[model samples]
Target: MADELKRRLVHASGSGLVALYLLADYLAIGLTWQYFRYLMIVLSVGVIVLEILRLRVGLEWWLYEKLTREYEQDQFAGYGYYMLSMTAVVLVFRPEIALPAMLMLALGDPISGAVSDDSLKRVKGPKVLVTMFVVSAALAAPFLSHAPLAILAAALGATVADGVTIRIREFVVDDNLTIPIYAAVLAWLVLEFVPI
Candidate 1:
């Protein structure tokens, strides 16, 4: 439980990545969209290299043993998937869309995880799902308020990503990778299709 708590705390820190945009812009630190794009590119590439080293070279980090689940020891860890998904979200969506999606990942996932029982194979309980939806909707509302339907869609998308586990042969899809992308894509779709 202590280790799981540590993992969730680290997961919540992802909100700091989204904070880079707000703090930089307001502080006039000159983190322009193009620079952010470049940063994401660098981060994604770096994670790819690190993952290769970890998976292929038998490289082991101390944190890996403490934070990673037994299932993750034989495959890519969640943090690698996390950064890659954030990179994709930052690069593909506008700030209004991207920031909220990132929040869903940074905030919603960890919050839901705190309430979850990892022993379950699938379908988190209603309490966990409700918490995810409420937190996700609240996080997205400030950014997506211009379109109410889009907020619900974004929240629902994030909830589904966090609450369900999909296994593909040997791979289990990580919510770290799916939450932001799914939320962003769904919100984008609603915004694009249903005129406000």
Candidate 2:
């Protein structure tokens, strides 16, 4: 019970990272996309460097052990992938698609993780999928109401990407990276084909 509570707390705490996406989107509204892109690049690079140093120096082991998966210790942590993928999604997609996709990733993924018991399961259960969709739709509705199909597709893609863990050899692709990218791609496709 104690371990379960600890896991829940740790998972829930990841929702705080959503602030980074919100701040970036707010800045993108006021500043140029190029400015936001450059800022994200710099921040991602800094995080990568810090992570490398942390691994080398064995710094913050307790935090990493608590927050990261066993496979992540030898590779970049999820936070590094989060920053890198956020930057990539912003650079690859337009503001309309990118913002909502990032928002779904930032908020929905953590909610799903916190609520679901996927420790023994590989795929998300119906409860997890429903929670993820509802949360993502609620958060995305205001911004994406005009593009309902696109938003729904993006939300579903984000939730699925978050629920599945993809491994490529020694590296595990964190959902922090997959969720936004998948959501953005699906949303873009919907906008392109559906005439929305």
The model with the greatest lDDT is 1
The lDDT values for all models are 0.89, 0.74
Cα lDDT tens digits for candidate 1, 10-71: 88898987788778968888998779889888988998898788899988999888888888
Q: Residue 41 CA error for candidate 1 (Å)?
A: 1.6
Residues 1-196, model 2: lDDT tens digits: 5544564565445444445545755656555667767777898899888898888877775666666766677777777877787788888987777777667766677678777875735676888888888887776676678989987988878877877667679565778788888888888888889986
Off by over 4 Å in 1: none
Predicted structure 1, TM vs. truth: 0.95
Candidate 2 ranges beyond 4 A from true positions: 1-30, 61-66, 169-171
Pairs that collide, model 2: none
